[model samples]
Target chain A: MTNKHNPAALNTGRRPLRGAGINLFYLPAILILIVFTVWPLLSGIQLSFTNWDGYSPTKAFVGLSNYLTMFKDHNFGTVLVNTLIYGVGSTAIQQVIGLGLALLLNSRIKGRNIMRAIIYLPALVSAVIMGTMYYFVFQYQQGALNTLMVSLGLPRVVWFDKPAVSVAIIVIINSLQYVGTSMIIYLAGLQGMDHSVIEAADLDGAHGWKKFRNITLPLLMPAFSTSVVLNLIGGLKLFDVIQVLTGGGPGYSTNSVSTYIGLTYFSNQNAGYASAMGVVLFVIIAIATTLLNKGLDRLGWES
Target chain B: MTSAIRHAEAASRSTDTTGKGNGKGGRRIGHALAYLFLGAMIVAQLLPFWLALSAASKPSTDMSSTLVPRLHDIAWDNFTTAITQGGILTAVGNSVIVTVCSTVLVCICGAAAAYPLARRKTRGNKLVSAGIMSLMMVPPLSILVPLYTLMVNTGGVNTRWGIVLVTVAGNLPLAIFLYTAFIKAVPESIDEAGMIDGASRFMIFIRLILPLLKPVTATVVIMTSVGVWNEYALSNYLISDPGKQLIAPRVASFFAMQSSNLGVGAASALIAALPIVIVYLFLQRYFIAGIAAGAEK
Candidate 1:
């Protein structure tokens, strides 16, 4: 055991036993993850099947009744559709705005850094805070947008009082805050672009649209996928802004799956119901994102 | 090989043509238009926050008359009112403790576990890395239903520590992912060099690795801390006590309770956001880099 002078012994000294001993470094993390992450997740599945109201001592196994009840519940269709719209609509529109801005901002514009900072500044504040501020701006009569609209001799419309309008406002507000995320990713991607591809396209008489479609967009698949995935996921799990902005109100019309679960658990005290809904949402997100990734995989043809 | 050579020649020729052709008449106009577009976007981004700040300082009676702030309308009472009315100070304390403690735990554990994964290339290591990465993909709140129930059953509800545990768990995957990426960049020779001197693996990690990890550690710390500070969902659900809640939930309730009074709500929003805004303004460059690293991963 005392191979004190041999360098090669250092490698073998740690081969079988001591080498595996180093895995103890992983124990704290693995432990914390197991307790906090793994257990909760497994129990999440188990708890969903139990008729526990988050507090009631009497817990009984209920099988798939919670899922079946949710399937029959009238709000399920509304909430599920609302979630898909939020996730898809926001992700789709943000890509265009973010990519467009990133492209323009990537140019040698005056105060580009300042502009980039401004673009990204909204991302710094909590969505709660942003929603709070916009609550002022989107107020029915005295709000900033309505005031500006009236000044321009346009009709002053109610923004939050209506269900459809509220959903649209939520989408717009969220898209504005996160567009910079897509922008930053795209800007980074554009910055790291292999210029030879664009140059090669130029030599083939490929102009702006052609070169962008063929070369730039194809090369940006990584960043595009990153932006799309993050935004879609963020949209799906949205709770904070929906909480502050509309409170998923006007009769649950604006309720995302997350907000619905929060409401069911906290307000309604239907914990088992909430857990079941959570599982369903988890499965939905998994399936949706997997399909999305698969769809994007094909468009990433050059890769 | 021949086609690649031919393409390289064509690329150089096109680079000259594109460079010279694009530098002329069309560039100036496009630049001006782009500036105009960017200016409008900046205003859109800033207007609400600006109005909120302006409204915060204005007397409530005069808040709706104009969107601009006036010196005569400056109301120092709003800040005082915000503190007293909303339990703002208590919420801020809760946020600081929760954010700071969780970030520290996450950084330590994430950085620690990342080392062996980075150094030892094994099938198990790869599986762990993939597990951690996929964990990042799952909306952490997808598991919140169970997590919240577990906390409640364990007498963890309404506690700062409960929120902290949730925060650490949520932040770990990203922290580990980022740290492992950064730790991989550190030469394995450093560990080898330390090992030759009879330093235990743990000692090498402590004496050699931790210091080398300061930059990424800073990145992880700032990201996780800021995130935990803004976290509303966990704090909203897990911590039921009003006094123990973080500023995010408090700010939300403050504005909601005061929704009828835009002036006060604006003021409370500003007060809630002030600390984070100041921090962002200071460490903005690092913040950008940290977020970028976070995104690319």
Candidate 2:
């Protein structure tokens, strides 16, 4: 396996025909990334330092003023808290529901295929569309839930009026819509599990809850990590759903950092401040992702 | 990322279930509980769509509860209004154009970039690979200020190519990662054999390596199209023109305008969702695979 002439080693290493000139193949992608991603990221940092209105030609250096303003902005604190809620809150719901569904459906049950398909279907639709459809349930007037409430002789409550309720609805919608993602990942984890290990546990009198707790759950750690990271990032970047459902409204009460950036830059014309929010968002996500990966690596027993 | 691809591949092949016996009474209770949970979830998952369908099929004058089905006299007019007044059809067209262009660009650029990193494996190429992969973590909205500024200054905003370029960049990292992993698994002998036949490196990549990338390319195409089609954060701002807006933003704006006409709003939302739903029904496996690959990012 260590020999250079072995095809496996050769395939992973620098091969004979794969010369330096071939590096040109990646130049276009690298260029696109540089111009579109890397450059904007750098410029975002630069823009954060100046008080430049988004469209204006002239600007003055603001030093740390934009970043400093965040400390004093009450709405900024709420938005930050909402962002964490969306991220951690959605991740929690998705994992619980997703794994529960995966555990139930990973069997010889009738309609399991259709169940899986239907469960995962929402993940395929645009979140904006999902959010709009979900509005039928939460609409103040003639909403489905309200109709149900009225039929039961209860009061029809306005769902999005309160900040807490609006935030919870956002989290629930996001989690339900993409919980299928985590479900499928866990299903795959279940499918890829070494059956022999499970059978051995069975032979050793491990069954049902005991088996799942001691064996199945631990075995699913890789999938758990993958799903958690994906869900967390997706939830943190919660934009489309919030945009459609609440529009981060009721006085910016439900704005994730992502949506708040939009509100500040577009509506408020605070591009410099928005750029600082963007920088904060980038740092938060980068740090969160790295920490999760590291922490999950330590937690995963199979590796 | 490779783990996702591997897991999906494994999932597609294995249908084995952990249905080993437990204590009889406990097992029966567990099964009952599972069934109860599954039924509840099914209803919960489908309820919104059901409500939307009911609303979409009714006229604004039909103030019936959304929980009830519009069994008879279903108003097709709502969907028609969605197309006519909501501009959903045009938005769909714009989404298609952007999605197709971005997906194709991502496939080409991703596969091409992957060849060197997977085959050549120079220190610089490895570094480049790591850097590109890292870009996947940068949420698009985080770069919104500068990216939008750059697009405006470059006259890139509101143009089809503008959205296309931005989406291609956004999607390229995952595409490249998927491609690189796939290409690495391809034996080096294939490229060596091409070289022995006097093919240039580019020729070998195109003539030999490219053909072998079909499976992974399917994954990339499926993932990129879904992503680019559903994209909102950047697309909403970069292409604010009504005619140029993608489906997500277009639907959001339409929903906003139709607040007084909830039926029309529901119709527009359903219309926007229809294409992806149809595609998902037909290609469920690929969508699952796309999730697996996308989950890695």
The candidate that achieves the highest lDDT relative to the unseen native structure: 2
The CAPRI quality class of candidate 1 comes to acceptable
Model 2 lDDT per residue over B1-297, tens place: 533533443343233444455568987887788899999889888988999998887788888788886888888898999999889999999999999999999999999999989988778888999999889999989999999988988999999999999999999999999999989899988888775555678789889999888888989989899999899889999988898899999999988998878889999999999999999889988778767765654
Residue-level lDDT of model 2, residues A191-299, one tens digit each, is 8888766665655555566567767887899899999999999988889998888889998999999999998999999899999999999999999999999999998
TM-score of each: 0.92, 0.93
Residue pairs with clashing backbones, model 2 = none
Return the TM-scores of chain A for each candidate in numbered order: 0.93, 0.93
For model 1, what is the error of residue A97's alpha carbon versus the real structure, in angstroms, after optimal superposition?
A: 1.3
lDDT of 1 by residue, B21-47 (tens): 565568788768867877788888998
Docking class of 2: acceptable
TM-score, model 1 to reference:
0.92
Give the fraction of reference interface contacts each candidate recovers: 0.49, 0.72
Clashing pairs in 1: none
- What lDDT is obtained when candidate 2 is compared to the true structure? 0.88
Q: Candidate 1's residue-wise lDDT over A32-89, tens digit each?
A: 8878887877777887897777777788899998888887988877888888888888
